[model samples]
Target: MEERLIMDLVPGLEGIPAAESAISYIDGDEGILEYRGIPIETLAVKSNFIEVAYLLIFGELPDRDEYERFKSDVTYHTRLKLKILRMMEWLPENGHPMHYLQAVTSAMGMYYPARDTLDEEVRYWSAVRLIAKLPTIVAASHRLKHGDEPIKPRNDLSFAANFYYMLFEREPLPLVERILDTMLTLHADHTMNASTFSSRVVGSTLADPYTIVSSAIGTLSGPLHGGANEEVVRMLAEIGTKENVRPYIEARLERKEKIMGIGHRVYKTRDPRGEVLKGFIEELIAHKDIDSGVFELSKEVELVVAERLTGKNLHPNVDFYSGIVFNGMGIPTDLFTPIFAMGRVAGWLAHWMEQLKTNRIYRPTQKYIGKRKEPYIPMEERKRATAR
Candidate 1:
């Protein structure tokens, strides 16, 4: 006789492979990640933001013609629709940037209603529009938070440079622009992260790209995901100085409180993204000269934590130095995670496109843990049934 198979249910799908994807790879034990088989560091040093984005969404490097077309398409669509602008203005000035991003992006599906998610032309244009407008929306949200007027997107500038322009209505230094570009590349994609999975799940239902992206942004707003960077910055401020690092870390460790930014759920060793950002932070500190104190404090804290966390496989994840790098670039901590969403929009859309190819609505099984069915009771016996 043939035997039936029994499957074990994993909560949160921990260690379960959800879907097959070729877009990105991660070896958490080895502390390695790659996009389309290209090392992130290689792209970080050599490629610009748009090129890396093209590579991620399309599955390979773009040639000159394709690259130019892709860049032009993104540049042309970079401006927010007047309706989107009005919506931004409608939001409370004090509301969270991520929340505005989520609401506006979801509403885009209503604005530009999609007739099809599986159409190549529709998919391509939707991806381009989301990637192009994300930075603009995020920058506008930041400006609104400060009661400042929104700056229009610039066609002449690169993606990162244009974001900075929209952010401050001023030109970024060449070095800063390049570093910010590199940061965008570093964040462009990761293998099945929270937001990526969220996007894929929504896309599986044949939802339009805008709704899929909005769903991903909502996932990103979670404290355990994208918000960790903002927490890192706040934690550093709470520590205040290098002198306070030791005691603060000791107390946290003794209390078993998490040392935010110091460890990761996936990586067993140091996160390569963290290492890359650390190098950028060091380079930025050298350039700033006068205000390297925060950099020093971060390093001091790392050293103290390193000694205590020796065998815990703990090391600085991407959040550790990314906050510092953004701070060095004159960006506030609150906007850090939203900026992350801007970068990650590429990855989310890529996964969305990929999911449509062999679409299957995500319907995972659950282990039921409720009382077995009881016999139906008459109305007269219902009160006595509850006492059981």
Candidate 2:
């Protein structure tokens, strides 16, 4: 008799190897994240976002000439075409920025055709356009929604500083610019995250880079992923006073509700990204006079959460501290996830490139539990299901 194969179904595919990747790595148990074998902490502190993006996409750090060329390419392509901006003006003023980002990104494909996913030049320019214009799209969407003319990108500014300038029409202070760049580096990629996975899944189908990235942005907009930072800021605002931290936490726990940003699915200890953001938060607190109450409340919430939930290995994740950092810098709360999407786009494209190298459309098997073949009933013979 031929042997029968037995397969076990995994819910959510947890602990399942979806694909082989060389882009990024995470050791959840040890609280470590490395991109191309370099520690995240080293990259976050030493390298700028554009350089980090180049490394992630190209699989290695660039030489000085290579770095300059890549930076120039990205900077030169940062402005949206006037037609793109005109189209954006018609988007709903009350629409979520993420929706604007996704729609505009998908529409980019019509303007810059990249149907030949196998062509190197096509892939290179597509990557450049996607990376360069995401910040423009994000900032434009924000300004348009608020009834303001979108600020154009300044070619003279660094990647992070230019984004800040476009959003507020003023250059960030040196420290603020540095922190914003570091924040982008810190969020640039995480191994096989929801958005990265979405990118890979779409890329496997040989889709254009814009469509792949747009799909990933849609995935990141969900509350459980990049959207959590927005919720974290809201949670802090709701807590109001530092004294209310414990009570708010206790009540949430008592009601079996989630304390947004307090836990992560992979890390058993505090998230490494969270640790980096905490350090920056300290620096901002000492140097900047912006609202420190949110920062203080964040600390108290973390402390209370640690006191109550540490034994269960629930600790502050990246979302917990990132909002405070952005909020302190005078960023709008809704823009948090769009900024995250901006950073993670590099990773999404990196994974898209890698996926094409060993392309096989994802077709995971499912264990069926529904009824098998049944006799077809005549329309008159079939009874309507009883209403619950």
Candidate 3:
């Protein structure tokens, strides 16, 4: 063994980059976003969610025949397995749906036990099942908890349309569907964030994609991670009305508290997704007659907070505007994270497939800080140390 310096990266610690994908790209500093090399604003106005997903997975926009086939295949697989339905029924109504989703996805791996003949075809089908059933599972969990009837998936509608239908048991208005589709595309992927990193870590073990995605979902459930959207909604609700915005933000700044949705790990300037979502909120407010004062309040909060903390280099992220948009769409506050999972599932599956193409077990070493060769003493023999 080489006995490297503490906290140093050993050989092969930094893995090779995967194949070039035409998925979403993040330029954190410039606050620019692109999907398939086209700017996000262009896609938001022209492309739909399904088209974006196909592009991410298959490397380009599908032709008419290919798009139709892809839509049919996904729609056919949208219905949950009977056993999975029963499993959802068994979950407590008060339980968080993300927890239920993580459990169900892990259980799915056991139900469809892995085989020695796991080939590309197997992986492809596994991806299909995961992508198809995720929305159904999330929608069912939402309805079950709220004591509402679960709506069956309609094969004729687009992915975003069907998801809205299942959630509300009615077809969504065209503008609503368009906004949601764009939102999905915007969130489909980014360069290796926390949840994507978690999926890749699990996948590096040559584990099944289902297990990898399940682990990713668990990582995303943390408040500091995927739950930021929920916190944003909560923050807005507490702020109450337009009149309270300034004072509320000023008070928060004085306490030196970090506002949810106001900062990012990768983006030092502004988040491009935040810009896109803000536009969506503006459209929804104007055309849909939705109250978007909360969005204005959030913007004011961003400005005041940034000015006060100058050197902190804070900026509002995607989650900042997403909360207002979802709230305006009449989505319940509790379902925010589950909706985020809906968007992120596509990215997770894509990353998992990419990892399998170059499978390597992830095993990082940690610094050893504990005493070396310490004797194991009986419980009574040890003396308690005084607090410093």
Best by lDDT: 2
Off by over 4 Å in 2: 1-6
- Residue 388 in candidate 3 has what lDDT? 58
Candidate 1 per-residue C-alpha lDDT over 1-388 given as tens digits, one digit per residue, 9 for 90 to 100? 9995547777677877778999998888988889999888788888888998899999999999999999999999988888889888989987888899999888888877875987889989988988899899999888887888889999999888999999988889887898888888888898888899999999999988999999999999988788777787888889998899999999998998999888888888869888888887677678854367788888998899999888988999998888877776788778888888888999998888888878889997777878797898889766754655
- Candidate 2: tens digits of C-alpha lDDT, residues 5-30: 64988786778788899988998888
Top model number, TM-score: 2
lDDT of 2: 0.90
Q: Which residue pairs collide, candidate 2?
A: none
Backbone clash count, each prediction separately? 0, 0, 0
RMSD of each: 2.6, 2.0, 3.6
Q: Give residue 235's lDDT in candidate 2 (0 to 100).
A: 83
In model 2, state the lDDT of residue 79: 97
TM-score of 3: 0.88
Q: How many clashing pairs in candidate 1?
A: 0
| Angstrom error at residue 343, model 1 | 1.1
Q: Model 1: how far is 159 from its true place, Å?
A: 0.7
Runs off by more than 4 Å, candidate 3: 1-24, 113-118, 292-313, 379-383, 386-388
Evaluated at residue 286, the lDDT of candidate 3 is: 72
